[model samples]
Target: MGVVSATARSDRYPKQDRSRATRQKLLEAAVACLAEHGWTGSTVTVVAERAGVSRGAAQHHFPTREDLFTAAVEYVAEQRSSALRELPAQDRRSVVAALVDLYTGPLFRAALHLWVAASHEEQLHARVTELEARVGRETHRIAVELLRADESVPGVRETVQGFLDMARGLGLANVLTDDRARRERVVEQWAGLLDGALGD
Candidate 1:
């Protein structure tokens, strides 16, 4: 085997912004594929084509399918967290509506696919568990920040957790059903409840 210099090793991995952009593109493509077609259809070759990158380059970025999808999960979580952080000052009701919509949208759907796949795949299960915990904590932090709620208040954290659980259940039930009317009503009702609980 040939000895490799430190510079060469650094070059072997993507260290520049352009290379990072390519990796992000691949990850975005993987998320889209997972959301649109589920786990089995999100192969490395398919992701590479969707990303408009060569298969070789895709492999260079992510040598394994699991690595690609795991990174995709992290990318999605980061994107969601960033967007949540930048939520403009809005009426409490509107913010609640927006939060509910987010939990019921594409990012959650893509993650749901991974979660189901993880139920049967050990490697995926481990990755999902770790990433999910981190993402979940970040999401909770963002929600608390956006709401400006005092977690020290009685029942505050539990109430927030309840709302999240309710939103997740609504999203899961909505996968194969047309419940838009009911969903809207439920969101409005929950928004009112949350506002009251927050002393707003």
Candidate 2:
């Protein structure tokens, strides 16, 4: 490979830039279809339509429903990570705060709904479970890495996870409930968990 050709290729593609736009479109479509019809009922054709792309294009990009779902899951995870990129290394509470916003936020609801619906699809259950576990393990890994959970800090993952669980469970409860105050109250409880988790 000549330097000129290599440089030209890099200039045009930049490695990370290639396929990102298409991937984003496909993921958005996947989420849309999943939310509209649930994972079991969401067909690749519907997703293609949602993305305003050819069925062949969708298939070329994803290859299979599982592939698309996994990509969508990963995309969501990446989006979450991007939001917290500026966070300082010393702050574990920032991770917790991001976790709260993630569980209770708008995009997360689509993921949560798609995931729950995915669980009921027999053909996709194992695949969905794998994706869900991947996301969970990432959260745990972040807690471990940032919080430095070791024998001395025995329960870092457990403590962070349990705190998140309460926020998540209550957040879910506010989804259909019309009372805005309830949701705000539940979200504010994170302030308490933040203090406890950060030893402040």
Candidate 3:
């Protein structure tokens, strides 16, 4: 009985690992497709092909297009949050730059696509709205931590939120053109403003 039990456990692990790996691949591929092609172009079949998994396998994991994309965005958001948490103590300027970089990445691009689609798609609206709210709260909390801001200090919370909003605006601008030079100037100016607004 013990030997049979051990054999069964060993057999299960490989299958479980493969399933996890497949799901991860699908999520990543979905994000890439969304970022590169936007919502109208990113379909389940396309994502499955990009992931190098069969459509049947992708469907088994996600069941629907909405499920795949929402999960993909959520998964990448968690990963970005983890990366943010892992940053070592840095100067406020560095922290500001790091936060801004978050909005300029592939994850943000993919999430923006999802947001645009959700605006017109009833089936996706509620799920995307909830996900964005959760992600927004987490990002704000992380920004506060990274900036060492005391929200107890009046205006500090709003200041942090304003910075995030500005970063998002910069991201939107970059979608049309390479705004690197202008963004650098803006980042420097914002870091100085943040230092004053969220003082030591």
Candidate 4:
């Protein structure tokens, strides 16, 4: 292997404002297209048009379809992530309610779109999986520990994973059913379920 220069390595990851702006535009356009049209319909041309850039520019910024989808998913995931970034000031029940709200909210719709894209597009599959894994990483560990659920729980990552899985399933279900009040009621029920585990 050839020896790499320190300067070259440093410049490899530059912090330039223009580059950041371009990336943000690309990501935003990808999200818009993915949400509105879907993966197959959201071609590079459409994304470029949405971003006010040339198709070549979009391709240069993201060499593959996977890269573009990954950025879009990350952008969408971050919207929900802000809620959990700072700990919410509420009782566990209220907190769980808020978490449930997030599940059945706009972010969930974006994720469902991403999931659909991933299901059909091989290139986007890993990107969508990464987005889901992000949620799993953020919520599952705490949930499992709090529930006193084992980390090696069958078919899941302990308590947190089980709850998150259910939450995701319910989000999709609610979307398909278009039932909001009923979903919140379901959340209330699961909150009671977790409450049972917590010696309530």
Candidate 5:
């Protein structure tokens, strides 16, 4: 090949980068729409508009509404999982508090909308079930690593699982009413209990 100009090389990669950027934008917009307005409001057209992209482009990336939303759910989960991996070092109490905040925040709200909608939509139910399982496993992995807790010990695994289940229940409660004070109280108590049982 003849001398490849710098401009040509740069131009070649931008098309792919732009495509990825657009897809990411759509995913993020979908999450925001779901959290703010629920699944009924998160139409592909609405998500595209929120992302500042054309409906055609959104459809090109995600041919079906299910495809778009399922991808969006996975996208948010993966983003949160990645962030969890990079969390700065903190004491057990701080980590537990942070984890509680995460479970009750925007990402959890977005997922709540999807879960409720999925219960009524047969096609969506299957995808959300699978996605939720995968995200759950990843979250568990991150928690275990962060805590360095020995799951092999008797009751340790059950306790951790129970804590996560409790957090999720609290998160669901937070959607309909103000459960912040109760959540804080429970989280602090749980943190202390966990430290007593598992701390170095």
Candidate 6:
């Protein structure tokens, strides 16, 4: 009986692993599709095709379109946050650049589409709003830790928020064009400001 039970449990592991992999593929494909095509163009069928999975498989992992997208963005955001935490200690300027880079990537683009869709789609509004709030808080906390900012100090917290706001603005600007040359200058200026604002 014990051997039979062990065999059944071991057999389930591979199936579970495959399911998780399929889910991950769907999530990644959804983010890519949303970033490149925007919300209107990114349907479950589109994502499933991009993921190389059947539509039924995608639906099995994510019951609804909203559920799929919201989970996709959240998953990528968590991955980015983990990457941020793992970064080696660096100079203030390097850290500032890293934070800004977070907003300038595909994840940010996908999230912006979701935000726009949520504004007009009542069913998606609450979930996206709540997701954004949680993501925002986590990003803020990561920023503080990466910058080693003393939030207890007067104005320090505001300075960190301002930096993140500036980074987000830069991200929005990049959606229209390759704003790297201009962005680098802005990053340098912000780094100087941060150094002054967050003194040793």
Model 3 / residue 190 / CA error / Å: 0.7
Task: Work out candidate 3's RMSD over C-alphas.
Answer: 0.9
Regions more than 4 Å wrong, model 2: 1-19, 88-96, 143-151, 178-180, 197-200
Supply the global lDDT for candidate 2.
Answer: 0.68
Between 2 and 6, whose lDDT is larger? 6
Q: Residue 33 CA error for candidate 4 (Å)?
A: 2.2
Candidate 4 C-alpha error for residue 167, in Å:
1.3
Candidate 6 wrongly placed segments (more than 4 Å):
none
Global lDDT for candidate 6?
A: 0.96
Model 2 lowest lDDT segment of ten:
143-152
Stronger candidate by lDDT (2 vs 5): 5
Q: Give a tens-digit lDDT track for model 5, residues 82-194.
A: 88789888788887777677678778999999989999999899999999999888877777777777888888777777777877888998998889988888898999898
Give per-residue lDDT, candidate 6, residue 130. 100
The count of backbone overlaps in candidate 4 is: 1
TM-score of each: 0.88, 0.75, 0.98, 0.73, 0.92, 0.98
Backbone collisions counted per model: 0, 0, 0, 1, 0, 0
lDDT of 4 at 139: 61
What is the C-alpha local distance difference test score of candidate 3?
A: 0.96
Looking at model 5, residue 176 earns an lDDT score of: 83
Candidate 4 TM-score, true structure as reference: 0.73
Candidate 4: misplaced stretches above 4 Å? 1-15, 142-157
RMSD of 2: 3.7
Q: Which ten residues in a row have the lowest lDDT in candidate 6?
A: 1-10
lDDT of 6 at 114: 99
TM-score of 5: 0.92
RMSD of each candidate? 4.7, 3.7, 0.9, 5.4, 1.8, 0.9
lDDT of each: 0.85, 0.68, 0.96, 0.69, 0.86, 0.96
Q: State the lDDT at 198 in candidate 2.
A: 49
- The count of residue-pair clashes in candidate 3 stands at 0
**Which is better, 2 or 3, measured by lDDT?**
3
Candidate 1, 68-133: lDDT as tens digits: 998997898798788878878888788777677766777888889998999899879988889889
